[model samples]
Target: MSQDYSSRGSVSRIDASISVPVRTFIFSSLLWLLVASVLSLIVALKLQVPSFLGECPWFTYGRIETLQRNAFIYGWASNALFALNLWIMSSLARFELKSSWLPVLGGIVWNLTLTYGLIQVLLGQLNGFALLEMPKEVAPAMVVAFLFAALWPAVAFARRPTGNVFVSQWYIIGATFVFPVITVVAQLMLLWCPTLGVMQALVHSWFYQNLILLWLGGSALSAVYYFVAKESGRTISAYYLATVGFWTLFLFASWTGPATLLGGPIPVWLQSVGVVAALLMLVPTVITAVNIFGTLAPRNGIAQAWNNTTLRFVLVGAISFTLSALLNIVFSTRSLNALVRFTPFGQAQEHLAIYSFVSMVIFGAAYYILPRLTGSFWPSAKLVHLHFWSCAAGSLLFVVAGLTQGWAAHGRTDFAVSALPGLLAASLLLVGHFAFALNALGMLAADKAPSNRRSY
Candidate 1:
């Protein structure tokens, strides 16, 4: 939040202790982000020109698209969370991280496992379930590595020196504990011990929804809660709502997944339950909006929000999160579902939730955390600006195009014509991701440069 950002100091011994491991995870995440961006562009192009990579089976739209999503989720997003959340947890708990090598080693193994799974996916060895496309063989390794990376944070939370726990810590630790359980359930039911009929779909939907809303969404909210307070120099505006919001999000978001299976092979009762739960999502969403935006109101003016790089990204993300929640409720209704189901509307919703809301928050957190970890400011403010605008424009374009495509489908418009905007959006995202990667790498390099070095 300070203009002299280069002088930002580490908050605790834990931050200094975990610097190397956190940097390892972040660097790996950047590489995977580049990979995902390239794949995204390819997949977007192939949607328009099916024969774009005609001769190569591995580059087929299905494979490339799946790989892109997996790389973004497991490779990019998960790694970033591991780095950011672990640090956030330790700092909040005022506990030093022990066995830093554990996270470093875990990050290495996790990425390697992801690499193997992605290769297998390209080789047509996918498990065929959405978001759980990675082959069953990789599941054990992924879980083990996740545990290794997650251990210190759990220890820090449990052994905190102080009795006072922050809202961010509550959300972070909740997400950390929930993910492995949901993931293991998904793996066991979908892959290891296959379920019968639509139960498979039910399980996958449940897992996917929880992964997005609980794990990814929860983590992003944690960052929002911390940074909003940090940057605004105030406690959260609606501090009392924080507890209710936390519990409701976890309680209701889990049941909302079955709404995705509306009018599918699932039973009507279950689908109805999901609809009710999805509508109920408004409870937490409204609370979050009030808490974040209320705290986000600037004492100066609009210019202040725009000038603060982290606040800019976080504000966009907070707005997107609220929008996503509303859209999800709309889509959950049977009338709207019938209109847009099987079209690109669902994908558009996912894009808004993940890229616009979750990834934007992650980017904002990275901008703040990397400087502290590396003891150097971002080397290029222009690149930071570039990254923000490109991603913002791209996410908007993609979401608009996707929703337009869905509506067009209902209007009997040509699919080919409808997809053109998506191609353009993907191209912009590729550029944004490159800028982000370069900027991050530059910061990392600056950390080691003789002139930038300083004692922690």
Candidate 2:
């Protein structure tokens, strides 16, 4: 057993050796996140006052919305996921990352492509689909860049020292493999070949759902499993159930696309299948919640768990995920769907899942991982607290106000007044983003002196 452990020195080397690439990814991600936040603020303000940015054609709602989504998903989320998953894969596989230069080059290319794509979007060259709005010219470059970026992690997983794989490894590997395939397929069908009229909508919907569930959600869950287990100092509870949850998510989640088109021209059977899939999502959600919540529950006492910042963020994210799942199930129902389908409810649900849940989990993982990667402690606990509260408060305000807007807009045509509060609430999130940016920059700039740091 000791020999088995000794053979894993490469994994330790990974932690010590990959600091430069990891910091590059993280720093780039935060910079993009700040950019996304500014775009989001603009969009929110535009919602309240349509004329706010109407003077410039590039700043029109449609173009800004597309740019905002691209920046958030590709710029912020994808970059952060690359850094986190690279570390997670190396840690789990007990191997050092090979060909590290590939990811660094890939990171540069990815950011450049995203910058070009957003510029094109602002210039009105959008593909006109929800998430696929990035110009098709950049798609091939993105695919190549992603392949390069993901190569090291893929190699590390393949060369894992042990047959035993952790739950986090499963999620990280699954997402890593799945994202590129779906992305290429979506690009071909929707952008390259151009699916027939209504089929285009279907294809776009399918891709969007798959991207959210299989990619973003998978990576976030990986972080959740890893951080929760590490911080709690416990192996996952009901381990087999986690496997079941993973498989269920992969199998059923993609079929949920048609539910988004309940009132559209899609076939009844397809919508029925989507609704069924949405409802079936409860299986994985419940299983995941049970396993994670059980492991996070008090062992000796609750104080340790309560005091842990990572655990607190993960727990809140888990709860948000579970609630989002329940709300998806509820809103997919025919009666409820009819009421909220055309309103801000869907946006509320999206913000809850992506911003509140996935982003929170990533933030927690950053809090834990950054210190180790940077060889320094976070500069200020106060900033961390400020970030947490601001995010929580802002999310609560946005969701509540969005729900209120949706309720008020249920049967009405003019709902601008109803959306005012949500717009105001969304502006508060800028404060949280600023707090995070300041904290991150301070940590990066602070001396890496051992004397100034607490032991991780």
Summed over model 2, clashes come to 0
RMSD of 1: 2.4
Output the TM-score of candidate 1.
Answer: 0.95
What's each prediction's TM-score? 0.95, 0.93
How many times do residue backbones clash in model 1?
0
Error of 2 at 157 (Å): 1.6
1-456: candidate 2 lDDT, tens digit per residue: 121223321223556555556766788899998998889888888877889978889899989888888899988888988888888777777666555677889989989998998999989898778878888988889889988876566677789888977888888888888888888988999988987878887888888888888888998999999988887888888988999999999888889999988888977898999999999999999999888887877564235765888877777788889888889999999998998887888888988888888888888888877776656668889989988888888878778877878877775545677777677666777788788888887876663322333223
Lowest-sum lDDT 10-residue window in model 2: 1-10
**Deviation of model 2 at 413, angstroms:** 9.9
Which sections of candidate 1 miss by over 4 Å? 1-12, 298-303, 448-456
Model 1 lDDT tens row, 303-395: 566678887888889889999999999888999888878888789889999989988988988988887777667888888988999999999
How many angstroms is residue 158 displaced in model 1 relative to the true structure, after the best TM-score fit? 1.7
Clashing pairs in 2: none
